[model samples]
Structures are given as C-alpha cells and as structure tokens.
Target: MKQTIEQLADVELTENMLKIAKRELREDKCSREQSLEQMRNWVLKHEDLRNVRLDDQFLLRFLRCKKFSVPMAQQTLLKYLNVRRTFPHMSTQLDFLDQKLNDIISSGYIFASPNRDKHGRRVVVINAKGFNPKIYNSSDQARAHFLTYECLMEDQATQICGLVHVGDFSGVTTTHVTNWNPTEFARVFKWSEQSLPLRHKEIHLVNVPATLKWLIDFVKGRVSSKIRNRLTLYTQDKELAKHVDPACLPQELGGQMPLKAIVELWKAELLAKRETILNLDKIALLSDRGILRKSNYSSEKSSNGMNFVSQIESIEGSFRKLEFD
Candidate 1:
C-alpha cells in the first residue's frame, strides 16, 4: 500500500502547521478529502491522461498549490504532464544513478538543504559556479535541477509552506552566461511560474557580479509580480543572512554544516527516493488524444492566468543581445 503523507518520513504536519495550511492555503481537513477525490476522478475521467498517480498524497500537492481549486489544480496537472512530454530530453531518463546526473549532484550544483527556514519553507541552493558548461550542457544542468525539485516537492511541508531559493552566482563567467539561450531560460522560468505546482516564497541571489546583474532584471520581467516582489539580490553572504536565517543555510552561506556535507546528505536523500523519482515518467499524456496540439503548453494561460510565453517572447530581441555582444 502507498504510504499516507503523514506516514512518510520527514513529514511533520503538526497542529500549528495544519492551522497555517488552512489559513494560507485553505486546506481544511474536511473539504480536502472531497477535493482530493474530485481531482483523482477528474484525472481518471480525462482520456488524455494515462498512468497518472491516483494516490491522495500525490494529488494533494496539486490541490494545495492551487489553493484547493479543482479546475486550477487540473490545469496545472495537465501542464505538468505536457511539460515533461514537450521537453523529453530534460525530463526523461531521470535516473539518479546516471553518471552525468550523479556528477552534477556530487559537484553540489543544486540541492535542497535538509533543513527548513524559520518560516518552514525548504531552502533550495543553486551554485552557478559548480556547473561546468564544457562538461555538461544546459539540458544536463536543467535535468539536475528538475530532479532535485521533484524530490523536494514530495514532502507535504514543502507543498504547504513553499520554497526559498538561494542562488549563489559567485565565480560565474562569460561561459556560464553563454551556456543557456534565451528561449531555454524563458521556457524554464515560465514553466516554474505557471505550470509547476510550487509556491516560491522567496528568491535570494547573492554574490551577483555587475556583469550578470542584467540577467536578474531579465528574470524579474518573466515571473509574476508576487515572485518578483519576493525576489532579493545580495552582494555578499552577510547581507543574505539579514533576511534568511543563518541556520537554514549551509556553512558556505554562514550556516552550521559545511556545504559539502549538506550536498552529501542531499545526495543520500535523492538516492533513497531513486525509484520514486524515476517513476515520475509514468505520468504520461497521450499525444494522439489531441489534448496537447497547442503551440506551447507553457504559453497557454490558466484561469488565474498570464501569457508568460508572449511576455518572454516579446523580450527575445533584448535577450538575443547575449548572442551578438
């Protein structure tokens, strides 16, 4: 039998947390049962969706992300499937044991802290310098990021409290900037803001070089105002500590444990959930069913919507400056 969310390890759904979930996400215990049933039934009834996970725990992540709105949850779920289908290269063969992915994890390119911030949000750290563009292409880096976030989202706490992103862009060079094209950047940003069922509470970019500062402004234009408002840039690690609790960060960022230790711990966590992560491919969308004939799934606006593709595409001319200059 599949484990209930509460039964899962590392889940601490306390009374106070439940109250916060209700207050913030409208996740009432009584009504959520019905919502879950509705979401499950909706997926089952949809002819385009196949091999979708019907478990309560799996469905609840979508429901909570959409504030328990069945229609919004359904739309996000479809986008979630469509994204994987659309970007088969980045989404497929997500085996943790694969040498390329394993190298990325071992290099500590991206990983979620095993600890949570004071607000109970998970802290996902991305070290841009760790990524060697020569060894691994943009897709490899994207796959590593995709795999890490997928593992983190399994915890109910993450779904309820949301995530705090701390990106360390120190040591970034021209190679890093040139590695990812504008379309790739736009697609990933749009998907994260619209399609992914993730509550991104805060984003902190530290040690940003003057050259890369333009990239920050570029990203702000792509995401929602809420996320943009929450986004912060820091010139130093100490400035970051003023906002995020030091205990929540790794020692490299002024936390207790060394970043290396934290990366090892995160690797173990991913290894433990290898099968679960690999099985994410099972949640498929049927192409012949005519559901995903649209030009771009990420471009399609949801009920609570914005046309991020157009927003991103409109700025493509400006984005292409990287190629020319």
Candidate 2:
C-alpha cells in the first residue's frame, strides 16, 4: 500500500507509489517507448506543442484514459488540451481567485477528502448544502468546480487511484433546484463522458429531498448510461456511510473535520499555485487555436478499437435503480 496526503495536509509519495508510477511506463500498449515516441513525434511535428512539457505523468493520464492505445491517447491528449479553447469560460487562470469565486469556494461547495477510499480513490465531496442558487449562477459554480478538479488532478495519487464523489444534498431547497441550469449540467455530463481523463468510479448523492427525486430522471437523459449506473442516491446521511467511509467524510456528514476548514485548505493551495496554472492555460489556449501547429489528427481515429467503444456502450446498456426511483 502507498501513503498519500493525510488529514493534516502534508503529502509524500512512498517508494511503492513511485514504483507503480514507473511501472505504468511499460505496462500497456502505450509502452513508455511507444507512447513517448508518438508523443514526442506529435509534439515535434507541431510547433505549438513543442514547448508544451510532455511530462511522463501528464502523458500517462491520457494514455490510461484511452487504455494505452497509442493513437487513441494522442488524439485524446490534443482534444483534452483544447478544452479551454472550446469553453473559454473554463480557463485555468487567476480568475478562480476572484472574490466572488473565492466566496463560493469558501462556502464548502466542493472539496476533496485528504483520505483515500479502500480502492485508494480520492473522495470528492460536493456540499450542495452550502449552495445558494440565488447568490451564484451556473458560470460561478462551473468555475468553482473547474478549480477544485484541476487542483485535485495535480496529485499523482488522485489521477491513478481515481475518484468517488459524495454529493451532500442536506440543505438543498426548491430555490437551488430551480436555479440548476440544465444546459450547463448537460455540458458537464458530455465533458465528463467524452473528455475528462480521470476515472470517476462512483457518485453517491446523500440526503435527497423528496421533491428532488425528479432531478435524477432529468440527469439520466443527459448523461451516458455508464455514469448513470455509477449513480447511487440516498435519502439520508447515514445511508451514505454504508457506501463511503465515515472517517473520509467531512463533519457536515458526521465526520471529524468541518467542511469549512477543508475548503479553506483547498482554497489556500489553489492560491499558491495560481501562476503555474495560468501558464498552463496560456499554453493550452495557444495550442487549441492552432497558433502552434494545426492538429492534423482526425477525431474518427478514436473509434477504431472496439475495446474503448464497447466500454462506453456497456455503460449505455446498463442503468442502476435508486431506492426512490
């Protein structure tokens, strides 16, 4: 077993983790030599990507997402980098440090648990109880989400071990539900389905209000079956503990630490990395627009292998039923 960040904030990768990270270089079809060769070739061919640091860990994210298929990994990496270009508002910059954005984040809207689950997946809790639809719109919420996820991705353990989400709906009201933007929600669904590099193992929604049950159906239509199957809804907080470790949860959900303090730590870390994040966005913006070199790769290349396609189709075929549903 490898050690990751604990409750108090210091994170150090153990020798076992280092070994696992190194082993990935040779384990899949995107073997270190093959993948790096292709990535370096792709970068060399495009002037824009030349300056982009093709760090092994960074490249591995795309490779693992694509099951280590060289061509598939290449195409996904390029497309993933172009996310900022497609959605300018989702830029990874100092914008997240804005007062309003900070306010939303400070409210404990979303934060990751320092602890990992049995599978070693990091726990990401979305404190919907802290959400006030009146004060923050979809864009504000989206930025807050982007910041938290982006920062979380920086941790090697999170990228490899994956994530499980806990949506605490304890304080949700009609106002918040009404304010939920279906369009933005759909966009997020599509992004998670097609582009997000991490493996979202599961989603546990706790404290579901009777009135909010319909929201599940609304989401089912928009998200792929894969995600829908991972959805688990609970009417109360205790039911959530059956699925997630109590110690891994925030005090808001009967855990040790207060949610506010957890969010504060995450906010401080984000502020510290402001410059590095902004520079990454600047590079991506340049590459996305072909300012560096036009991505000659075609999107259709992603479909050649049935393994990846079937992985998605399998999700489409299955649907998990919630107790309320």
Candidate 3:
C-alpha cells in the first residue's frame, strides 16, 4: 500500500503520506467529516485560530505543504488567514463578475496551461503582451491574478503537483510603469511569499523588454530572497523554451493553442464558479468579522506575516520529523 519514491516525486497523494497526515494532522482517510471535527476542536483550544476557517480541504493543503507537521501547518494556516485580516482592502472583497476585472482575467494575460510538467505540476502562464495598462491599473490586475491563483488552489491535484509560472513580457513598456504602485506590488509579492500554501515549482519570466529592466530590478529587491532566486529571466523565447517545455506554453510562445481561445476558456470557467470564488473572501478576510479585534499577532506586529513563519520554524524541530523527508 505504500507508495514508491517515483510516486512521491510525481506529487501524487500517496497512501503513506495520507496515513502520516491522518496521524499527525488528524486528517481523515475516508471522509472530511473527521478531519473537520478535529480541526474545529483544535481551533477552539487556540484563540488565534478561532476566526480562521477550518475547512478540511483548505487545511489539508497546508498540511501537505508542511509535510503534515501539525504545528507548522497550523502556523502557516494562521498566517494565511492573517494576510486576509491584515490587508482587508485586497482580501475582503473580490468581484469576479465585474466586467473590467473579468476582461483582465479573460484576456489570456494569466491562465492555467492545458498541459502538465514531468512532475505533473500545472503550468500557469502570464502573457504581459496581453496587458493593457490603459484599461486596468496594477492593483486591479493583481486582484484578477489573485483570484486566478485562488481558483487553482481549489483543486487538490494542483496543490499536490504544485505550479510552474511563466510570465511573458514581450511587449510591456515603460508607460505601463507609470500606473504601477510599488507599495501595492510589494504587498502582493509579500502575501504570496508568506501566506499562500501552494508550492512554487518554478518561475520563468520570458521576453523581457529593456524598458522593464528597472521594473524587474525594483521587484527583485522588494521580494524575499527565496522568490528572487527562484525567478529566471529570459530575453528570448529560445532560452525560455530551453527551461519550460514549449508544448506546455501558449501559442504566442510556440505552444499548442492560441492565447485568445485560452483566455475565453478561462473566462467561461471563472464565470461558472463566480459565487464560490466570491465567498472565499468572506472566510479568508477578517473584515467580515464586523469588529476588527487584534489577532494574537496583528499585521502591525508581524509585517507580511513573516513572524508566523519564523515562529513555526523555531518549533518545527520539536515535532515528530515527517517520514517523507
């Protein structure tokens, strides 16, 4: 019943990992009912985790991300919710049905690839050429990006297999930079570096125009060192294709299908799940709580929730070491 190294490396939900999760994180092997109950009970015992959503599927992502180390996963989950609490403006309200937002999202600027990598990780492509700064500002476009990532996280397969991101900046210009908010951009990157439970298998930025060099440089310093190092910049499609399979890229970059059609498909898929996506803010953010009470460690004290990760790391070795690693 145990999975081999090949299965684990493939990112499958192996039997052995599930059993370990069941024991350490109180995950259920059969149904979510048991896990949900256990999470609720555990949350009730801790004041900080009270407002945090105890959804079985959501918690499982954190557990798997941390290799089912309960304490570390709990902290990651806390930081995840804390992001929503800290930045209510970005996290509290997301309207998928908004025509302008939908336009940006459905523009094929950002979408999941139809193909997977050798590790079964889903590829998320971002075509900067599709971006029209004249139509949407950086913040507005960021919301769409957030929603796209959020929707992808809903699928357990995507979480396990992880994600590879490709950003094509073939046609971006300095004029577009006129509309960017450096502060807001930092917050978005910080949120992903600290809160999001999804694994980042790879990051590729292709077709970088010279005008955007300073923009990229600015972003490099703003982001965490881990993210900065994980990023790979490419000036040509040939170099980009060397790292990412062209078969997994959009036609704009020598891939299978047209970017326009891919955008339309993404739009249709998002519209169908409009309600569910909107409701995520209700639980993810603290603004919905009516009165803003201070969490044990508020955003003012934590700053991008890095404190949670630090605290989690300090206690990580104390917990039973996971078998997989």
205-279: candidate 1 lDDT, tens digit per residue: 999877667768867765679999999999899899888877778888877888898999999999998998888
lDDT of 3 by residue, 58-113 (tens): 66677666655556666666777777677656655567787767777777778887
Write the residue-wise lDDT of candidate 2 on 198-311 in tens digits: 768799988877766665765665466788899999887778887887778887787777777777777787887676566666554255554233323222122343343233
CA lDDT for candidate 1:
0.80
- In candidate 2 the C-alpha lDDT for residue 325 amounts to 23
- Per-candidate Cα RMSD to the true structure, in Å, reads 4.1, 8.1, 11.0
Model 2 residue runs over 4 Å out of place are 1-30, 47-51, 94-96, 285-325
* Best-matching candidate per lDDT: 1
Q: In angstroms, what RMSD does candidate 3 have relative to the true structure? A: 11.0
Reference-based lDDT, each prediction? 0.80, 0.65, 0.65
- Backbone clashes in candidate 3 total 0
Per-candidate TM equals: 0.88, 0.76, 0.73
Candidate 2 residue pairs in backbone clash: 48-292
- Global CA lDDT of candidate 3, please? 0.65
